[model samples]
Target: MARDLRFEPHDQPAGGWGSVRSLFRHATNAHSWSRAVPVLPKQNKPGGFMCVSCAWAKPAEPHSFEFCENGAKATFWELTTDRVETGFFADHTVSDLLGWSDHALEAEGRLTRPMRYHAPTDTYVVVSWKEAFDDIGARLKAFEPDRVVFYASGRASLETSYMYQLFARLYGTNNLPDSSNMCHETTSKALPESIGVPVGTVRLDEFDATDCILSFGQNVGSNAPRMLHPLQRAAERGVPIVVFNPLRERGWETFINPQAPGEMITREPTDLASQYHQVRAGGDIAVLMGMCKVLVDRDDEAREAGAPRVLDVDFIQEHTHGFEDFISRVRASRWDEIERASGLSRQAIEAAATTYLNARRVIAIYGMGLTQHRRGVDSIQMLINLLLLRGNIGRHGAGILPVRGHSNVQGQRTVGIADEPHLVPLDRLAAQYHFEPPRNKGLNTVEACEGIIAGTVDAFIGLGGNFVRAIPDRARMEPAWRRLKLAVHVATKLNRSHLITAETTYVLPCLGRLEVDEQATGPQIVTMEDSTACIHASRGVAPPAGPHLLSEPKIVAELAKATLPSNSRVPWDDWVADYGRIRDAIEETFPEDFKDMNRRMGTPGGFPRPLAARERRWNTDTGRANFKCPSSLNASFDADDDPAVMRLLTLRSNDQFNTTVYGYDDRFRGIHGSRMVLMMNADDIIRLGLTRGGMATLTTVADDGVSRRMDGFTIVEYNIPHGCCGAYYPECNALIPLSHYAEGSKTPAAKSVPVRVSAQP
Candidate 1:
């Protein structure tokens, strides 16, 4: 079936009656509405399961309806009544499934049993669990210790991730490539250098007292709907909220508080942003520089006029180093250069600076829009600079917040999952487990792809996430991925990667976040870390989707038992029997972070891990906070002086989460039944000689001598910055080369890809 594309103007406020209807619709469609009647109230409450969607932090007290529209969609989808059983596989071939859309493939339902791909028939057949484990163990033993890549997703719980990393390291390899390498690798790399920690400084409750909020590179309404509550409250209290993005998002403009009874009946949404600036793609560095310049220039004038200084001299002198050099660089940045690069006039930047100066307690929040670029690290550091100028760290209602994508991505990293072996103190793990971990650095996401392409990697095992569809340059990676000797995925549902089979392909069914996981010690509980670094216990209340499915921790432990040496001291079976044993092991490994993790898990809101930056204690090399001084504002990508070239930004639609497409409609954007559409400014559409609904092909402007094109995309004129266009991901991911990444971080620059739009023949 061909996907039908439709377009219309969406002018309604985000998250009002529309969201209520969407939640009800998806719940019924997934056959989970009735189940949710009992399960929904249990979500995010104390000792309850957290939503398996985005990792937005929950409030201390839970409301009757704590989950958002997208959260409800995720819950219902995971606990759907439909099942992909043996008969379902008999009905569809891998070849036929390959032709279906991502949404269609997912809608086929959950996998009830383990499956293996048969090459001759190009179909997946049911396989016993023992056979699957034996095949995987044989393949792993056949390959060199370093020839296997153990990939993880943010969806993995901390207990699962810890066991995975320990198993890989004990097996004499550290080739752990994770979803974080593709998303917030910039934040993980940059924050430590600036603030002496790789985590955010704010808590969930700080939003209540914030005087100003600056949101950059994130669509708060669609991505993290729970954030809308705080944004709406800030707006109601007349706190200035500033938004910076290439496109004017509807959620940032106005939002209806779904929890409020009067607002839902009246449909009168609260106005959100006091100011919205459509900054050009990859222009965050320039905008930051412009804001800093305004502050520095104003401070100098204040000194001359005998007024109060704008910069926080006391905080800078007491806790920071390298201020003089940073101030000099900010002062030296010319307004013309800032204007040209940022695509905003000096006056507008000054207005934003005024808002920043007026607020003593400010919060700066950003998302992947800033981190998914070649200059991502620089952008993250620049935000810290802006916050540090006002002494925002360790203050009430003031700090830096990097909104992450996955539910437990930050937690996964916290529990020791990294490409760099040195990031975790291996001595503690080695002493605890009685094995020496690999000392050398391992392959990151890009390096892992290169290793597969070069045939240096023999086996690939994914704990979670759709690897092939989630990464960049699918055309290149998919073929390389298929050549691997062994491929195993522990997932709940069907996805594109499962269809892209290897020589020995196995799909092992695993329990979802909302399912029961029974072991010898009875039902188990898993722990996850939210964006704010709060570690909490999550107990699934719903029944298991399938009787045969295993928990993620169990799957990892069983795989380790099959592959590891017989004399290994890791106690895999014992940990699998009781997850409390896993938490005990985790506590023993990271004593400081999880000293009393088991006891703390019983706390009402759980416990927050130690954050050195939150206490204004510097843990950097110099024992003080450092201000980074990047030389140039120019992007890393090669750009021509041609005015015809436009930067293409791949963004998520309102109805989507990462690559998970819940439906065909993007209600917030007024887009229906279409994922193959480009959002362009009216002036840009006219300049390219294209009318609304006209077909166009987006060709990559790369010097690699290889051409990448996405064809048959309808053009939709939108309220976006000129010289920039927007499209959805996994569709436009083909146009991005794996080499186009942040220099040190190796994160794919998915946000800003230079391209040309031409009419399709």
Candidate 2:
């Protein structure tokens, strides 16, 4: 029988007044304030580890408090007073912990030592580090290297990532699947095909030169609050910021920067968007296509009258390929079809296009909403095409910005955490490590889950991250996780992933970025790459809460030492003892701009990675950036195919960052007490004969009859687009089938899922 789970609702006090009271109380209470701030060293020097929460990148500026609310929460949670010691695990069973909520489990506090689950006792028994490594090594040795998968999270450092990829290649497996494959894979896949580089081309300083900012599917204030300052500056300078989203997020409309004292004290906020359009979910591609088509038409008319084309014809002719093919498709497309599919009239599209035309420099910013659809790659390509219509590719203020989620996710890909069919890092590994690397393709996150379910994968090791709960098909995935021969997690705290134990499971505690890592060679520095392709160093100032806790680099090195044979060429011990040696290995293998990495990174305001932005060079095959045409202009899903189903888009709450739920309340969205409620258009709710606050059932329309129908969920009437509905993710992950994913990217289509809503029985 399924276990009964219940959650209590926590009510929050009203607005700015409540926040002021809480701040005052927190400051006055010595214990509260001290406990909140993680104990740190008195050094004025900045740390190497980037903030693991968001993608807002700024030079390491000197400030009283460099952390944000979510960053603070992450740090506090990592360096909490509570410790999940051997005694605690001995007292609780894995099954019991599995019944706990995600927030509650993490709140239980940090893990101190290595633990191994004993199935006979049905409890987690503490094990010595040596014994745990020996057992894990034996199990790993039993399987083929290709079958053994290694997963890395975005929080990993560049040195750690380099070492991990090196170890994997030596062990003979190309399956270096990571968190990026699920999030920004579309951007990485599409941007490079169009612009010759996979990263965003714009810098923060470029905003000053930009006349217009076209933002799509990105919620800046909530996701990356630091970005709001530049946006606020742009707005103040009379630059028009256009927003396109399925739902009207408050952050997009207005924002209050907590960093500014006057604004915080006065409760004054800055207006963000000049024009906000609530486009239908999955309709972004069509909308972009319409705007591009309009530009082409206008340019054609000017050219016909002996005037120069509105678009940069010289740039297109010189830099791009496939222009004629793209032009033919755009000319053949009808305005009526584009308007109907996009849910935007011809006049509105024309007005939007005019803004793009009038602006001297424009930046197009997008997030997961554009990349979590069936044709996500196509959608990304369309956005790139729009930027390329003008000479935007190699310009300062004009380019593409794919707002990444995890702080270091971009870094992970840069260091070779990929399942690329070609470009395997193993070839370099064989030369460096003197071992035959695995050549066979390995499983991605989704495939890894499937492998476990099919009983093909016996051992699972996660470097860091909430694997089971983060993936879709939760009901199916949780069971598969339990069947492993050995399940090992290197984590900072207790999460849902820890409880999913095997016959023999281990939880190895690791030091967080905020906590100081004491190595053989003294303090170690870690590096992370930002969204803008800037590689910077992070150093930990705070002492670790417990001495037993090890750094991620140390843990991986120890594990590799125990697993690899004596003949292995990789120096596992040397790499962990001093991170500079690891960086040297990276420099030798994949030689880039960071030659004297340590010296350059130590300089104030860490160095930039090798990007075309700094040089104004396009690394495409033709010596310039290429512009490709979108495959199709159709954006609307065929609702007639499933008449009863309503399209559902999964979202994150304002109080939350990614899968970590800091609280139940979403203050900005006006949601309180519950996360199970669905936001819908009031007109759509009334049209369907459903009353506000009414209970409803949402069924998936698929052939498998796998219906995740929730009956008690409250229906909320909100200002969403007519055909769209919204629900918080990880909770609504049950509704998304594994098969329903992006075509080229293979990322789960969490932004677009068809569901049918009905009154509760």
Q: Pick the candidate with the highest TM-score.
A: 1
| Poorest stretch of ten by lDDT in candidate 2 | 1-10
Query: Taking the tens digit of each residue's C-alpha lDDT, what string does model 2 give over 1-761?
Result: 00121222223312234334433332332122454454322122254345767766654553355554445545545555666766776677878887887777776677777887777877777778888889898888887877777888777888888777766766667777788877888887887777778889887678878889998888775687667767888988989999988877766776656556887778776777888888778888888988888899889899899887789888788777778888787888888878766767888888888888888689999998888888888888888888888877677788888998887888877777777735455566678777776676677777777787788877777878887778888777778778777788888878888777776788888888767777889998888777777677778866786877888888888888778776646778888889988888877776774667777766544567777743556766766666666666643345635545677999987657777876665666777667878888888788777877777777766667665666567788887877788988878888888777777767888887888888777
Error (Å) of candidate 2 at residue 529 is: 0.6
Query: What's model 1's TM-score?
Result: 0.98
- lDDT of candidates 1 onward, in order: 0.87, 0.74
Model 1 backbone overlap count: 0
Per-residue C-alpha lDDT of model 1 across residues 402-429, encoded as one tens digit per residue: 9988899888888888889878879998
- Looking at candidate 1, the ten consecutive residues that score lowest on lDDT are 631-640
Query: 164, model 2: CA deviation in Å?
Result: 1.5
